[model samples]
Target: MDGQPGHEPDCKSFSYTSLQGGNIPESEIIVAKRKMDPKTFSQEYEASFESYQGVIFYCFNRTLSASNETVQPNDVLHIGMDFNVTKMAAVVYVRRGDQMHAVDEFVTYLIRQQ
Candidate 1:
């Protein structure tokens, strides 16, 4: 195992001796025990693990992908909006052929007198 001190809070603790004694190879064990960045590990790793048991998008049957297409001048734009006292949000969509693509989203913060 590397000499780096283990200070990462989110990663599970494992001893070098246990890892070495196991049937698994040193390389694989080292990789499995490596520390993940706190922000990414917290947001993506924990959420995916807890919600889907390590399978991403467990609730969805189809995989969703992102596209880089922009809205054309002639394309019809559809907007959906949600408003609250503290925040407002909107989504912009454009129809291309038979498919509707979400092109942009906007959120604004509103300040209210306490």
Candidate 2:
């Protein structure tokens, strides 16, 4: 225990639901649980393709959650998805002949059917 390479004897890890993160509000906790599964939300780590990087971040005069973009019936839809057993994430875009506009993003945890 005296000396170990790549080891921190005093370092510890705790989840948000655990003793250390009790101060978090119930509303936010509920959102976090919904965005991620209980385990991933608690452990706070994942090699996710995307994680609350928000739906959009590069454009000016645009909000994150709400956008004015609308999809027409003839528009070509381009979607990017990260599908997994535990969670599913997707970004939706409407493609014109030469350009694509960001429209929506969706993420949800999968429910086991039994």
Q: Top lDDT: which candidate number?
A: 2
Off by over 4 Å in 1: 1-65, 112-114
Candidate 1: count the clashes: 0
Against the reference, the lDDT scores of all candidates come to: 0.57, 0.61
- Candidate 2: which stretches are off by over 4 Å? 1-66, 96-98
TM-score of each: 0.40, 0.36
Tell me the lDDT of model 2 at 3: 40
> For this target, which candidate reaches the highest TM-score against the unseen true structure?
1
lDDT of 1 by residue, 43-99 (tens): 433333333343222333233434566788888889877674467777688888888
- Across 68-99, the per-residue lDDT of candidate 2 in tens digits comes to 67877787778888675567787788865566
Q: In candidate 2, how many Å is residue 13 off?
A: 32
